[model samples]
Target: MGIGGGVFLGPVLLLIGFASPKNIAGICSAFVLVNSVVGLLSHSLQGRVDLSVLFFLGLVVFAGAQVGSFLGTRKFSPLLLQRIFAFILLAVSLKLGIGISG
Candidate 1:
């Protein structure tokens, strides 16, 4: 699965230079969470959701989000977080470019 919000939000948020990497990450996470909820609801209303997969995936993502939040807030430095975001943006761009080319 792909990261939904970061591709659009990350670069712009970084460019805006929020108070801290932690704050930026938190904002992105909030956006993504809201986006996911809305998507899930819309798909579910349309009778497109797979309950089994959603249950399993939700559990995994919940755990992952917790860990990532902890790490982003506690373990990584601001500079390191910035670099990580940059790298992720670069990687996503390259992947999209390659996919389009192919």
Candidate 2:
């Protein structure tokens, strides 16, 4: 399911009586970390991982995540964050569907 698993997870958590948004967010973060590690290992075993590419991507992603977290904590509304995430998901889906590449 790749990262799209979040589309399932968030709703499932809500339906299962975890109505607290903060708890859901924590669960999602943990899920992401675990999934990322698993994905990385799987790709590495298949000789699909390029360390240099992964390093640069990881650095940029980490920096962006930190900035995003700061904004989320300090000023951004939850609705805004949700909309931003939705847009990102849409764009990713479009790119994949269209077989777009850099």
lDDT of 1 by residue, 1-50 (tens): 35665578867876787557678778888898888888889889999999
Error of 2 at 36 (Å): 1.1
Which lDDT tens digits does candidate 2 get at residues 1-102? 355386568657857977554456557767887888898899899998999788899999889878866787677777776676567657767887898834
Candidate 1, residue 3: lDDT: 60
Model 1 alpha-carbon miss at residue 82, Å: 1.3
Best by TM-score: 1
RMSD to truth, every model: 2.7, 4.0
Distance from true position, residue 22, model 1, in Å?
1.6
**What's the TM-score of each model vs. the native?**
0.84, 0.65
